[model samples]
Target chain A: MAKIPIQVTVNGQTHQAEVEPRTLLVHFLREDLGLTGTKIGCDTSQCGACVVMMNGSTVKSCTCLAVQADGAEVTTIEGVADQGNLHPIQEAFWDNHGLQCGYCTAGMIMTSVELLQRNPNPTAEQVRAGLEGNLCRCTGYQNIVKSVLAAAERMGG
Target chain B: MFAPEFEYHRANTVAEAIDLLSSNPGAKVMAGGHSLIPLLKLRLARPGVVVDIGGVAEMKGITIADGNIRIGALTTHWEIESSSQVAEANSLLAEAAGGIGDTQVRNRGTIGGNLSHADPASDWGTVLTALNATLEIRGPGGATRTASPTDFIVGPLTTTLGETEILTAVNVPVLAANQRAEYAKMAHPASGYAVVGAAVVVNVDGHTCTGASLAVGGAVPAPVRLTSVENALTGKELTFENIEAATAQADNDLGGEILGDFFASAEYRRAMAAVETKHALFHATEVAHH
Candidate 1:
């Protein structure tokens, strides 16, 4: 099979690659670009472990194809932190103990980032509804909601 | 499952996407990939070419004009769930959007893809049918056709969409005054797809039901309007006893029509559908009362 040539902007950098048409965005991020921060928990698209921001929206990277993301802006967990500073969501998660095994942290943070950007002051129910797609097995998500609430309060909205 | 190896093409326009599909005998359009990718991986769909239409400029936004709402094929479920316009005009759509799969799925699943995919367990299908929405499709020769939600889906994982045609948009009418709707579902824990779901729309006239539409999903091969239940509810006052009695008709109406999978048995789903219908009706009545 011939590889499809496409351009995608990951985080803040643009990269051109000739990838197999069947190559998923998760594989492209982890293997080709070596941005291994995005974890792949399930290929069946059930788990939110592969969530990444595509054009400012969070989508399952495992389900999306690299070719499908042509010219699309993507932000992964690696992009969440800036210049040695953690994003408020990331910091809140740490302070609130939102993770135990940490497999779902990346996707959770990415999903939370997108949710808060759209909704500055989300209630606990709203946070749960917004993050329902991202699953965490180890933690009960009580702390995750708390972290989001803390971040919302810190953001002053 | 990984998708079978296939050629890839990115179409920037609806016409180009249609042409690509027409030219390729076994080509499938790729939008959000939330639905298609899994099928491809399972080898359930073995297209020779995968047309990436996610970036098609023509199929990308939510437009409201002339008392109608037009949603492009590539509009993600998240966009609909969060769109102030949809929330303001058609709250049922937003509520349905909020109930689909989860955050990741909502962010990537397209309404066009979901409708075209036509999974009976799909949350949006039930709500759209309850709303009497229309699906727009464009074919090889630039011909367009419209199918009501009831006519659009044929069975589980089946639709009226032709191989050489692409779903362009979904057009929905604005809700009328005193009309309210709701979707209720009992979802399978892991897949997040419904085990049984119901969508109810009601038009109230000063605490009396003037009109009612009910549709059942995740219980049959396709979501179907419950005409028997609607008939029972019409002209009836909004009351818990009335709604329960009317919704119980699902047990008789959908007994054999309900689908069975590893997640649930047909008999179980039929029973659950009745409960979901009651819940949906209750919610719809609440909305109408408000």
Candidate 2:
């Protein structure tokens, strides 16, 4: 099989590569594009560490083929912060100590941004439900939940 | 951790997808990459070619007319869950969609992929069985056919779909004003797949049970209709005690080999089959559960 040429726009920048059909999107982001902010905790798709925004929805990048994103607009954790300023969700995570080891922070923040975008005034249970895809092994999820709530309040929604 | 090498083809229409399937003998159709991608990574499924129908413009979205709801094959689970048309027409399907794998999985999983994979625990199988839904299938040369849930699902991870057939859409009669339906399940803690999912549709004129249709999944090799329970409730009044009594006979109606594993033993799943049926019937009838 020949390498398939795909053009994907990541973090508002277009990058073209001739990737194997089997190469996963996360591998392309972390290895090909050198955007390692999106960690690959479980390459089997169990862990949401490779979560990224595809088009307008969050998808597990580890399960997605790089070729499948031929013309998709992708947003990685590297794109969440504006210039040097952190997004409100990132700021809340920083203020609330949302990370114990910080392994799951990128995916958590991305999923939270999507959740808050859809439901700006979500309750604690809703926040928990929305973040069900991303798993944190260190924290018991109390502070992570708190971080999302704080972010929700600070964003005034 | 990645799928083995395979040729890839993108289909723009159902006819093109059928052409790809017929040409590539061992190709698999990928819709949302939720079910197929994991299987590929796990090496549970290996194909020489993969025909991605995700970009097919004709195979996305939901439409309701002629007293029926038609859901395109590529319609994502999230789309079905959040669709007001589905909720108003068939709340059972909508609720089951909302609870299907977590948020991201639901956002990526599609109805066609879910049904074609035919996982025994697939909630769509059980719900569509009770609803008597029709599965539209298209083959090469514009050949077409329809199969009900019972006929479509052959066994675990198997369906009646031919190698050259593409599941185009799912058609289900809208729930009438006199009918109520609900799907109740005991989802696996980690994956959220059903352990004992039951879907029930009951018709009541005032208080008398005019008719009932029920099916159980997760605990069986395929979705099994609870004919005994349906017969038990058909002529009786729709009361808490009546629903309980009817669903208690669920075991007598469960057909095929019972499914079990370490997480849920055969005996446990068998018992929960009755319990979930009762719960679904209770919820459908608005009967209070103690």
Candidate 3:
């Protein structure tokens, strides 16, 4: 297979590399860029464990090819923190105990960030509907929904 | 699971995409890659070349002309779900788009890719079939053709689109002031794909049904218009008894073998299709009354 040159910005940093056209964005983030915050639960695109922000929209990175994201800005879970300070959403998740096993937390939090960005004042049902893509086997999504609501209120929604 | 090794070409225009498709044998077009990428990763599809049309600027966005809402082929599901034009013009289309997969899938999946893939459980196909949407296809040498939703999908995961043809846009007739449409579906709990989906569009003149279009998906190899139900509903009062009586004929027109899986059986799906059709018609008639 021929390698294609791709330039992408992840976590506010630029990285230029040549990758196979078959390389998925999740693999590129975890392997090539050493950003393991994005997890790949189901490569079949059924699970949202590989969700990431691409060009301001949340997408399952496992389904997105690296070459398809060429020159696009991608934000992973690692980008949620600011200079060693936890983002408000992260803080809300921690305070609300939004994680049980912590495997789906990164994707859940990343999805929540986008959700709150889109709808600043989301209801509990709205939060549940918004986070439908990211599944959590633990906590029964009670605290997850609470965390998003708290985050929204903390962000002055 | 990694996709098989294949050459990739990013096309900037529909013509370039067509050229790539014409030049590369067994090449597959990649829009959002939500459907094809999964197939590629699963090794269900192995192509020599993968034409990436994600950057084709000309095949994106939503517009209205000639009393029709023209949605570009590359228009993402989320865009359609959120579009005020779609919501106002034909809400069944928007509702169906909103119910497809989940947020991540909808964010990355495009209508053209969905239709071109022609998955049997697809939500758009049923809604479009009911709405009588038209697909604009472009092939090599700048040739173009239009296909109705029913004619575009021939079988499960099959479409009338040729190898070198690109679905440029989908044109759906805007709903008339006296008309209303609704979509109801029984989605699989895990994948969010429809188990049995129904879409109904009704034109009511002072509570009397003047016209009706009904379609069902996920129960058969391809979405089918319930012509019997449509005919029965026409010229009848939009009442619960009439709607139920008409929707009971839903299974009469279903051709081919009914789809069955671990999630649902053929008998169960057929029964549920009738139920969903009634629900869809009920909601549509309610909207029409208001």
TM-score of 3: 0.98
How would you encode candidate 3's per-residue C-alpha lDDT over B1-290 as one tens digit per residue?
79999999999999999999999978999999999999999899999899999989899999987789999999999999999888988777788888888888889899999999999999999999998888999999999999998899988899999999999999999999998788888999988888999988898899999998889998988899999999999999989899889989888888868999888999999999999999888787773221
Residue A111 local lDDT, model 2: 93
Reference-based lDDT, residue B279, model 2: 87
lDDT of 2 by residue, B148-264 (tens): 999999799999999999999999999999999989999999888999999999999988889999999999988989999999999999888888888889989776579989999
Candidate 3 regions with alpha-carbon error over 4 angstroms: B287-290
DockQ of each candidate relative to the true complex: 0.79, 0.83, 0.89
Candidate 1 vs candidate 3, TM-score winner? 3
Q: Give me the candidate number with maximum lDDT.
A: 2
How large is the C-alpha RMSD of every model relative to the true structure? 2.2, 1.0, 1.6
Instruction: Report how closely model 1 matches the true complex, as a DockQ value.
Output: 0.79
Give the per-residue lDDT digits (tens) of candidate 1, residues A1-157: 9888889999899999999989999999999999998999977887789999988888888898888888899999999889879999999999999888899999989989988988899999999888877889886599989998998887786
How good is the docking of model 2, as DockQ?
0.83
**Quick one: best DockQ, which candidate?**
3
Reference-based lDDT, residue A131, model 2: 92
lDDT of each: 0.86, 0.91, 0.91
